[model samples]
Target: MKGVMRFGKKGKLSPRFIGPFDILERMGTLAYRVAFPSNLTEFHNVFHLSMMQKYMSNPSHVLNYEPLQLTPHLSFEEKPTQIRDMQEKRLRNKVIQMVKVKCMNHSKEEATWETATEMRSRYPELFGTF
Candidate 1:
């Protein structure tokens, strides 16, 4: 199986853990077979012990978990909840427009600055009239 790619950025800022997958069986010393959801069936089930983590059994955690609606490719779309701020930068003679958007499941620190053109195309509702 190929390595998993980082989301958004390419460095340590990327998420390291994806899930608390169920362990199906122990294979030899350092490897174990894990169960993956139907959407992630393309990925191999066997993984090294180093890659596995013991999920702390907590019923409260499950109760608070917000399960995202995943697409067929096991990815979910992040919808912009609100427009936090708008700014236009004057570079030389050109003006570049940018918008700070607050996305679902993300905090203020995680909110990203995206081009106004892209936001309009992807999420027209966010722009309202302008």
Candidate 2:
């Protein structure tokens, strides 16, 4: 997770919060040991409280998917799957056309706003001819 995770969307997408892992025991006043699954055994189990979040039981977390394909450096390209909407963004002395883009690996609620020209250029199929 070094540097900002650029999905290559050319946008400043925020970093993702990965887990709500089980806290096994308190290591000290500021740290706790967490239960790590076999796949994450390479990482240290103890972490500072500042680096962890409290686990809240959630019922909507049922679906599972395969791990994302990443390069040896651990990054992936974010491709727009569909253009959901379009509108004009008004700025002082200017108006910019924008597209509501639904990207792969994200839900409808996570769709983002991107410049229409950029989207059309990067994903011509979404725009067809012009």
Candidate 3:
């Protein structure tokens, strides 16, 4: 049997990994947990074409959904801390983007057996023969 794959004009292909699907699955679970307090279902709406594409385009922002908790009463010093946190986040995003570009350029997975052999030598007990 043959499988069909979609490709962009410049030969860019959709992600081969199921990472997007896993993300959507987790998000759907969270949504269900929030909506229904009890007897939650495991089935969740996973990321498809559009949703996955949107997230891949802006992964840093889309993935970071941590809620900020603030008391009904706000202190003046708290605002600056939040601003600093936001700036640090932006800087971290920039660093991630730079590293991603480097990683994308290398389309290779090191040989699994080679790694295992090296591990065996390092920790003989773990990969020892029976």
Candidate 4:
């Protein structure tokens, strides 16, 4: 329930629920032993009931299960695919540049706007030859 890092300063984008794993047994009044997928074997199987939610058994909500491709840190990467747009804003003597980046596995509607300097530094390959 608490392993994942809280994104940004406010934890606004952090995931609320991780899984709907099967409960193996009840450890106590407030604790439960749950079974996790083989891919998530690194994490402990036991969890507090407060950290879990009762999954609604809706057949229509089920999707094809694809085993997650995790990094060493147990996180997935969202690679930048292309720069959709670039813009510059001038304020007095300062000029700020921004770019809309399209990421792999994401749609154009989900493209995020980021500072040009940050994009250049983090993913220089996207810009190519400055």
Candidate 5:
């Protein structure tokens, strides 16, 4: 099941279970009428018993993440913050220079490696006069 895809054409990770929905009433032996939150209005309010799990009062939790400082349209662009490291790869014909750049709103370990020329063209301020 490790390589199985379920979300879409290229979706490797998708939430299989998405609820702690309150059970409104039993609809029969196996089905139950559940109450979905306002945000899940597009989904049906009924589900099978096999699809549910008993709610437990556990302190362990994963908090929801929300991006801050978005524009009026509720979106933010990623910007390069700093240059961490530089390297050159020598091939049979020539050498290719690469740079590791840190971007805004991302952790240090999340920084990505980009070609020096590409990074220069994208954010000239990051590598001033060089």
Candidate 6:
């Protein structure tokens, strides 16, 4: 049997899948989580990268409920400058640090993903408050 197709208002993408990272584009996260709940750190990495990719586009409206921005290109075509390269490098470093702090590490790098999950599970009053 064929199934019926549904769409969002005014031809916009489905809102059921929109979010801080346009979860539609990231359909793999839930599957990964189900497959490997222990790999929360890997999932965290994926989520952070998705978010950074979204922000790198610098969309005009985060609330648009649509994937409206194109991924930013690091280069145009021909010429390259040392200053531009350094700036790009710095931006990448900043993204890594943000992911490490906010999503993955949360402070201590030596802490394995298992340890982090244990902390979250154990200290339901502290980190679990989120």
- What is the clash count for each candidate, in the order shown? 0, 0, 0, 0, 0, 0
lDDT of 3 by residue, 1-130 (tens): 0111232112222223322222322444323112221222332343334434334465455542222222333111111110001111136345211111111211233111223333334444543331
Q: Which ranges in model 2 have alpha carbons more than 4 Å from their true place? A: 1-11, 20-27, 32-46, 58-66, 90-95, 128-130
lDDT of 6 at 127: 39
Model 4 has a clash total of 0
Q: Which candidate number maximizes TM-score?
A: 2
Cα misplacement distance, residue 83 of candidate 5 (Å): 0.3
Candidate 2 C-alpha RMSD relative to the actual structure? 5.1
Better of 1 and 3 by lDDT: 1
The estimated TM-scores of all candidates read 0.58, 0.60, 0.14, 0.54, 0.45, 0.14
Best by lDDT: 4
Regions of candidate 1 where Cα sits further than 4 Å from its true position:
1-17, 53-81, 103-108
- lDDT measured at residue 103 in model 6 versus the true structure, 0 to 100: 19
> What is the C-alpha lDDT profile of model 5 across 46-91, one tens digit per residue?
8888878876676896534333333443233457788988999789
Q: Return the TM-score for candidate 1, rounded to 2 decimals.
A: 0.58
What is each predicted model's overall lDDT from 0 to 1?
0.68, 0.68, 0.25, 0.69, 0.64, 0.26
- lDDT for model 2, on a 0 to 1 scale? 0.68
Which candidate, 2 or 3, has the higher TM-score? 2
Off by over 4 Å in 3: 1-16, 19-29, 32-54, 58-107, 114-130
The stretch of ten residues in a row with the least summed lDDT in candidate 6 is 78-87
Residue pairs with backbone overlap in model 6 = none
Q: Which ten residues in a row have the lowest lDDT in candidate 3?
A: 78-87
> Cα lDDT for residue 83, model 6?
13
Report the lDDT tens digits of candidate 2 across residue range 68-121: 444555355666788888899999999999998877667788888889887777
